[model samples]
Target: MKKVLVVILVAFIILQFFPIDKTNPAPTPGMDFLTIKKTPPETAEMIRTSCYDCHSNETAYPWYSNFAPASWFLKNHINEGRKHLNFSTFATYEPKRQLHKLEECIEMVGKKEMPLESYFVGHQDAKLTDEQRKLLIDYFKREKAETERKMSF
Candidate 1:
């Protein structure tokens, strides 16, 4: 037991040397989601607090993210999240994909599947109230309508 504990402690210490880079480049105003779509202030704030870490280029990494295995997990999760939805590059998505993504966003939030369960544990602030969830659902509804309207032209 003592030898096992000692080995674990040593491994933990050694793993700390390999840290993942979670740093994001400075945000440009033109590259923001609000710049492309009309995001109400409150809704925008909610998205920033709850969704941006994984869904955008900006990820506010926590202290534990510096630990080796944890850092790797964080990096992979962020990468996968970005692949699914990158709001930082929202304007670049083709219209069809954009529309589909918006629909998925609404569905995810309505089901409370977003800000994934693992994320909310560490980030209490990311937890949304019922009102916030409604606001997000309404916002997406409006956006989807607007997108469809434009496509009909």
Candidate 2:
């Protein structure tokens, strides 16, 4: 039993050597939501503080992400967040897709479902207040309207 325990510990140590990819890609010019939309400074700041880490190409990886299993989990979250809605690549999407994304953004904000709890754990700044939630929902709703208008033309 002691020998089996030793092997398990060794295996766990070996796993630590294999690190996960935690790369943050560079932002594309004029393709990001902030660049394409005339977002208010306050709104933009809030979004950056709360949502950018997972949803944009400008992730500021925390020191804890350097470890093995934690880094793997974080990378998975980043990939999933980007897959759902990448603000950095928002403008590159089709007009219809942009509109749909904006709608989803508004819905998610209104539901207080964004900036997932795990993300908010280490990032207290990412936790939205009632007003911040309203702010995001309102902004996304307005953007959705603008997208619809543009698509109609």
Runs of candidate 1 with Cα error greater than 4 angstroms are none
How many collisions between residues are there in candidate 1? 0
lDDT of 2 by residue, 1-153 (tens): 999999988987887898987667876959989878978899999999998898899989998788777888888888888898899998889998998888888888788888787787799989999988988898888888888898888
Q: Which 10-residue window of candidate 2 scores lowest in summed lDDT?
A: 20-29
Highest lDDT: give the candidate number: 1
Q: Which residue pairs show collisions in model 2?
A: none
TM-score of each: 0.93, 0.92
Candidate 1, residues 2-109, lDDT tens digits: the string is 999999999998988887877786676676776789687888999999999999988888877878898899899999999999889888887788889899999999
Steric clash count of candidate 2? 0
Local distance difference test scores for all models: 0.88, 0.87
Could you list the CA RMSD of all candidates, in the order they appear? 1.4, 1.6
